[model samples]
Target: MVAWYDPGVLAKTGLKSLLSETIGRQADRRLLDAVARPQPLAFDYSEDGDGKAREELWLDYVSDLGDGWDSTYAVASAVMAPTLEVRDATGQVHHTEGGDVLVFGGDEVYPTASVEEYQARTVVPYEDALNDRRHRPHLFAVPGNHDWYDGLVSFTRLFCQGRRSRGWQTRQQRSYFALKLPHGWWLLGTDMQLESDLDASQVEFFRKVAAQMGSDDRVILCNAEPAWIKQQVKPHAGRGFLDNNIDFLEQRILGKRVSVFLAGDLHHYRRHENTEGRQKIVAGGGGAFLHPTHLPRVDTRPDGFVLKECFPSQKTSRELTWRNLLFPAINPWFAAFMGFVYALLGWGVAANLNEGAVSAPPLREVLSAALQSTGSLLVAAGTLLGAIAFADDRRGKAWQKVSGGVHGAAHLVVALLLTWGVSSVAAPLASELQWSLRRDFLSGLLLFGGGALVGPLVVGVYLLLSLNVFSCHPNEAFSSLAIPDWKNFLRLHFDKDGELTVYPVGLRRVPRRWQHGHSPEEPVWVPDPRDHRATPPALIEPPVVIGRSKAPPLTLGTGQLAPALVTQDEQPPAGPV
Candidate 1:
């Protein structure tokens, strides 16, 4: 359904992105703060007088969502945590359950991350789902890139304001917050940056959070995206932004370790146990296009971390192919016709095999064909590249323009040569086609249109990847695609004994249409007895190995945020963790 060259999904709403950049963000933040009046909560895990307030700690997490489509409905249903009867291998019937805390990892919507978009896309659907529920859990969230596109101003009003939108409310004073779970456990989430680090204020906030923890405290850390999976897939792992942050938090801030890591950027479910004995999981399938879980790896590239488990496993054979173009609403901002355009353009890039000796059109026709094929993709990639170069230009001198020009020329030359070489190699075969095939206009189109993807797909895909190495975001090397598969999430429970049991629920079936609102399909209890990634045995589990996070008890002051947190139009502030 998704290919590097088939149909390019262009990111739109450039005007909104521009407005947010120039003036809209400040105005939005000011308006939201004045009208909504958010007061973020700051709670400490160690401060829980007694851990027995609740028998079990229940929480449901979903991330990278907010597209209003069938898939979105499916995800909303998945969040409902409906009762499902599944027969175990031994033929015993069992039902999986849900949690008391419902959290969203981020990316609540797409295309123009403004306030108007969230009320309908981010808040309404979930509100409907929650209202539809018999039991509703308290909701909390961390900001993802799409959410931050408007500088998190609207997200603040929509979710962070003291008042609740629907039933969802954010109590955290800042974008990042900490939740004290049962059994000396903590859940920490951050408002993250791309290719950047936490600002000094955020670091100080978390440091105070760290000061409150006893040395033996356990933490379940959450971030905006499931970056670890791409650690090996991309040339750089989250541009080392997340890893540095995590290291700083554990080593510098807390002087301790994290028990688990959860994130949702890639839109699928996977569980990996890192060499450090921590369970890193990706559960972004909260109502968005499903990204393929597996990717091709060059033989020479040594494998990165091995995934302990994944829903839609290797047996499922999920792939990124052109057939996905048929799915409507996959690209909400771009028209489906654009896919055909990308496809035709790819074919055009290779169509020139008949430009000379064969009965092909003139130079004008070839140029026309090539231009049509690459027009949109080139503009998109060029716009992104131009922004980056301009950023560089601002930091230095006019020389950045010269450097950019030389780089462009070199890349253009290489791209043209590769295209020509591939075309030349295939031209010999093109010359021998049957006259019936050659003369039939419809037949010729049917035969050659597919290759049009190679035009922009080739030059643009490679360029997008090459350019990504220099920074992050808008890199094809880091893009994902959709698939028709089960969406999933993680539900964690902490019992009286302080042992944790993680139930990874997979919604195997997505109904095509439903009259009554969709509910969660049957959930599977991922079986892993000895693995720390899953639930350990209740009675036989090893004792919690954490050290006291802090001294006997520290009399912490008020919340770290002064008047408020995140007031400025955000800049990419760099700090470790």
Candidate 2:
């Protein structure tokens, strides 16, 4: 039901994106930090006496949510569920209760942020999931690009104030915040805004938190975007890498104390570990469309980070990319729009020919007329420019633009050919049948039908080819599929012996069918058991352990571990585990 290819959806988001890049960027909302009253808890975290008082803590991390009901709600219900019992691929079972702290990594709402969208797509389902519970988890979030579309107004209103988001207690006073976890571990979230540029206030806030951290105290850094992966996929044209802000904070402010770097903008589960056992994870599959895990086509990063685990698998992601070939079937509304455009192109061509002439127009004239007409030229130019703009310009503007131009030309040629075929067929039929009155009308009708059938197919094939062959349009490629599976989030636990464990939780397929619950305590919408795709959550890989081991992790062969383990998100102590 959530079609990214829909023309209306495209136009609306496109306009908002334009506004965000131009007007929203000019007048940065984060500059209004003076408005927050500046809560003490926002910075200070020295009360715990260096992890001696507390024994353990749990926390949950999810990001890039708020799309359709089924997928988003499925994840929301799972995260808010009192307990989640998941198993690894080898059938090792693990169980975890809900966290005392819930961290939204970024992109809490999709398709342009608004209060209405946040309520409908994010709040309603989350509230319905756990509203009846007496104890509530504290919520913290960093803003992603989608959240920045409206200058973070909606995000600030909903999250910055210490209000309740129905079931969860909102605790952050600014867009970014730091929390002190048990056992000398800390969580720090950064708001890199639109340009990946941090404000002075944000830097000062983290610097204060860093000063309190002892030499052995570990930190978990949560960012909206996964700069490690983006550095390879879409690096800045001038700069070789894209993580300057993170590098500065990690080295200069945090003093390289960050043991884990977590993010969710990539929309899939991927974990990379360096030689020191430090983890970099991208677990963004929190309800929006799934992104490919097979991207960047590399097993390791230049910084010595090796790709250790990924959900949906790289092979599965490659196979999924092929689904875009059925574009018209996948997104019929977009196909209809393409059909309308072809019909208009046909009309423009016919208008150039003499209305009274009975003879069929030559194919050459049909093609020439398509080239000469002003409306037709506009259509051609629009297709080329739109495709070029959609291209991932970070891949080098000149080559990306040329590839996009070729993609647009494919669509243009197909439209022109379809127009000629319709005219050739319709003209002969009209002359033979002596149906003089409806000749032009019949041609117009044929053009619409043919274009509807073929236009979308062209675009789909273009996306498929561009992605798999050239490594382009990674966002556009998978978003067209709107895959509901491969949903994932992180559950982190800090244990008594000053060790941190990360569990990557994933769902193979979200339930499509739902039923309304009659009970007051239950979620309003529950996953219907009758749905074939309904299945239990599973662990994407072995639980990653940090702080105890400086060497690279050992491969834990598939086996049943006695103690069932999972992850959580929280700050300080809300309740005993």
Candidate 3:
């Protein structure tokens, strides 16, 4: 599980941001750009071994990958398998092979980006899946926010070296590149870094790529973030801001030739399509912790693209949001930290405990004592402010401020009430015992236990209500759960006649049990066959076809129409060929 809410991870993320900002100030990294490497005019894979224009091409788009071993490896295993036969809703099986070109959309590693992290979380899993394949896929990637964490030094070194992993070849010189595919199609991947804006050098690089594109040529623009959906979430940020880099590239550089906009920062599958059949898709569910799909309620984009489909439908997402009620169980370390805080707050109150009357202290006296202690006051103030800052602004900025105030107030009120109640009860007993060591120990035990047990529950319930009732904290609520299911990726096929079809592949559950393979021919690790969670891949939706006047019959790499689409009158094939 990638504990996004974990304090250590959060601290590291903040530190990364600080360091990146410092680097940005000292030297404009993007301008210096892939520094010594010679920029390629364009990587043209439009031809076959005979130097003739190829009739077909297959590509894979995956992003937001590289989290835990179980989740990451599960997705990698499914993707790297020689072929997949996924059954759709209507029992139509969609059979497809690993892409000739595997493009990582963005955020290849999570929490933080580094050589070790990528090697362990990403490279190792992918390499282990298919070690000795004859025809290896070419891999290209654009840097996401996570990839930008180390100032992109690690990303540039690992990916831009033009080296090869066990089962894939790295082909891009810079963090971004353009691939000229067959049948008048082009794939352009951009590195947005953390700013979500392209540098002058990047803009010029794309302009050169655009210069090579014919007017009728269609393009698949890959970005690190989905600006269309993001406009709805943070209306004033990124591409939503008038004439941002994305708007410029779409409007000026690529123009109407950009038939498809693909991105994957949000860890889910969503497709927004215009009436003209242009598609904006987000398929970020490679291996990271699942993000809630029932958020921002973006039924439409400003560009007139209507939301067509979302994997783990909004209803399922809302249902999954309810799991935050188990936050204490999911994040026991955080819960224990909260317990320590409560213990400190309680100790502050108990330290004021003197030889008072044998009876319980009055409520006013308890409150007064707590208010006088600087430590208690600071803790209460910090809790109130931190809760306020933690609130998500999905509804609006004003609503966020109001909801946050109430949330923080609830915590402070609970603390005050608990302090009063505990002090009132314990004062009588401490006075009777008249032993400082025993009294101190009892107070410490009580406060720590109470905080540990009660504090996390309060937080969990607050998260549950905020998300279910108010549509807030979608990221926070779900990240705390660190769900490893609902992983997905896109496999696209461009057939002989130039028609393109996208098969959205998904897995309902990731296998938890694994064993090392004994032979060189076998994968490094295989899922335990007895694991109940081992399920076949399924089509997230019917194959989405593009650029054809009418829907064409789907075909496989063997150049035959797919055998998986059986009619009611005919029995399906025994298995995928």
* Model 1 segments more than 4 A misplaced: 1-41, 44-52, 81-94, 236-246, 274-277, 296-306, 315-481, 517-577
lDDT of 2: 0.78
Q: Rate the local accuracy (lDDT) of all candidates.
A: 0.51, 0.78, 0.79
* Leading candidate by TM-score: 3
- What TM-score does structure 1 among the candidates reach? 0.62
User: What C-alpha lDDT, on a 0 to 100 scale, does residue 47 get in candidate 1?
Assistant: 29
Give the per-residue lDDT of model 3 (tens digit) for 1-577.
7777677888899899889877865775667765667779778889987899999988888899999888888888877777878999899877898788999999989888899999989999999987664357899998898888898888888888888889689988888899999888889999876467676667778878988877678889999988777767766443333225555566656767778899999888999999879899999999998888877557777668998899889899989987877877888778778888787776777657634535556777877888898998888878877887888875677877788888777766666666666665676676578867655566676777777767777888888888778767777788889989889999999989888899999888888899987765667898888897677679999999997443222222211112222236644355422
Q: Could you give the C-alpha RMSD of every candidate to the true structure, in order shown?
A: 10.4, 8.7, 10.5
TM-score of each: 0.62, 0.89, 0.90
CA displacement after TM-score superposition, residue 372 of candidate 2 (Å):
4.2
User: What is the TM-score of candidate 2?
Assistant: 0.89
Candidate 2: residue 565 Cα off by (Å): 42
Largest lDDT belongs to which candidate?
3
Poorest 10 consecutive residues of model 3 by lDDT? 554-563
Q: 1 or 3, which is superior by TM-score?
A: 3
Provide backbone clash counts, one per model. Answer: 31, 9, 0
Which tens-of-lDDT digit does each residue in 355-403 have in candidate 2?
6656767879888887789888887888789778766675687977898
